[model samples]
Target chain A: MAIEVRIPTILRTYTDGAKAVEGNGATLDALFADLDARHPGIRARLVDAGELRRFVNVYLNDEDVRFLDGINTALGDNDNVTILPAVAGGSV
Target chain B: MKYDTPLEAVGNTPLVGLPRLSAAIPGNLGSDGHGAGAVRLWAKLEDRNPTGSIKDRPALHMIERAEADGRLTPGCTILEPTSGNTGISLAMAAKLKGYRMVCVMPENTSEERRELLRMWGAEVIPSPAAGGSNTAVRVAKELAAEHPDWVMLYQYGNPDNAGAHYATTGPEILADLPTVTHFVAGLGTTGTLMGVGRYLREKVPGVTIVAAEPRYDDLVYGLRNLDEGFVPELYDASVLSTRFSVGSADAVRGTRDLLQQEGIFAGVSTGAILHAALGVGRKAAKAGERADIVFVVADGGWKYLSTGIYTAATTEDAVEALQGQLWA
Candidate 1:
């Protein structure tokens, strides 16, 4: 079984327009490595210096990975990972 | 219960318990499986405010702070980017205090919000709906530059916005439910979370501050995903213990459940907040720990009635009906 990763509109270019791609790893770090193997250069946009990029947000099963273990957050077989650029949020 | 004016009656909303819904959660029963009141849910009914949403707290506070700081004065124009509630609250306050109100709102927000803003004597400028409130904020910023005299009490970054909750909402909650173990609220400008989170953290030991963020691309009105490129300046991630991305489907289900089971009619964002509240409650129940989780009922269902969420035959249908329109 593999983890499902949903890509955002801006990052879809890295996935060749594929909205979602599957990767296998026990932890998010390994999952990005697995994904980078198939989709080269995609990991750079999401991570820098072994940390999640400033504007990029990755969620595992709808929970923010930042509050988890960051890039080291564990991944389950059926986990859903979503990657999106940080945008201004809220009704300010 | 008595106030000098409607503007004076903004805060001190009721914090009511959700007994029926709390008991309905399966694992809420005690270890011996008899008592079902260990895990409880409470709603901070911010809908009871003057403008019918929690925004009233921040809107009034921001404006008042600006006034006290000499940024806002008599006959000054107040500019803000709002999905709805903040504009309405600001407009009402401005009208009463003799200030002009201009709101830059998303074009896709419900018509009810537009009419309400107009009724409150505020001019509305429509921002693009593609990027949601992000676009609105950008437009407001551009307009603020052009109108130098226009005081933009930017709620997203304003300290007083969060300060409102810290000074009032937090104290009221602690006073009403001193045992509150967790505080959950919809993640909008992050004012509610940051302010109340800080206040609760200072008093309540190990209080879990949970943010019920709308899932990216879910289009729940008045809520934004932090990853969407615009984290409100007021949003301090450290203040939040954890964040839950609630989708339209779950938000719809939560709204319907609150209405059906608890008879609490609230907007879609409240549904998302309640969903997170229940999530943490379930965790506490499973661990057999007593918890008092309080979530914000941001607003009433009156403005959202036109969206058909409350009357839809099923939650799926309600979610489907909410597409393309901002339901929160």
Candidate 2:
């Protein structure tokens, strides 16, 4: 199964400047491992000690993976993964 | 409802029903095709506030709370980091109370917001747009330090921001819809959800408080993602049942749906909130449970008209038109 992972601007360098890359894994952890195989050191930026980095937010199909199963969240075919750096949101 | 002054006319907005939109959802329709047991949607029309947005509730309350405690005295300058509504609300209050108002806002915010702030006699300071509101908040904090005399209400971390909703918005919703099963609002400073969520949780046996957060990098005007560096001090995860991340396209679609189906022309963030409300409503309907979902209409669309959202040819066009601009 092919899952599309969208990379943030800050981490575009690791993806060879590609905005999105394709990977396959049953779970997000395995997905990251697949991505790391293709893009070395990319996994390190997103994960630290098997936990998602504090400044990184990963969403699977617009749902926060943190609220789901975090890195262990199961991935399905046709799922879209988005990774973004934590920035201060809009001021209300 | 007649009030002594405009400031006194902050809350008590209309709670209108969205029968058409609610019935359009397949899940909301009963098995027998009747209205009973159908998931329903109610809008708390916060755009009806004096300053034309829900921020009036917190802005007025924060200033009043500060005044009551002697922190904000006459002639003091009130500083804040705002993309639009809060600054305009504060400026209106400051003008009436004989205090100077200053707002640190992102440069990418709609021109209407800048003009509104200036019209209300607030001094506007523009921050960089790279990191969005995060940059604005940092700049405001720096400015506050440089000008210690200026009292920054600091809505992101201020208790009064949420306290304002707890005291007024929360009670108003319950009084209007006692059977409200779900409460949804945009996630910004987290004041609305925390305040209203806590209030409903105490009174209602089982109430679901859902937060509608902007999708990361989607940039819906006034909403925020908690995972983002700055979690509003008022935010408590325990208070929320679940959070939905909405993208700009979905937000635009929801906004158009509200205007087209229900005639509620609200800000972009409200559209995101409605999307989340509908999501939860669908879940409850799928479970064959009755639900009374109430969502917030954060602000009016007047300020966002220049962004071409309401008049765009299509939802995609609307989303494109809103690029790099804070439509909420």
State which candidate has the highest lDDT: 1
Q: Residue B57 error for model 2, in Å?
A: 0.9
* Backbone clash total, candidate 2: 0
Best by DockQ: 1
Q: What does DockQ give for each predicted structure?
A: 0.49, 0.43
lDDT of 2 by residue, B100-127 (tens): 9999998988899999999999999999
| Least accurate 10 contiguous residues by lDDT in model 1 chain B | B218-227
Put down candidate 1 lDDT per residue, B212-251, tens digits, no spaces.
Answer: 8876353422233334477788989999999987777888
In terms of docking quality, how is candidate 2 classified? acceptable
Pairs with backbone N, CA or C atoms under 3 Å apart (clashes), candidate 2: none
The parts of candidate 2 lying over 4 Å away from their true place are B31-37, B216-228
List the candidate 1 regions with Cα displacement exceeding 4 Å: B30-35, B216-228
| CA lDDT of each prediction against the hidden true structure | 0.87, 0.86
lDDT of 1 at B74: 89
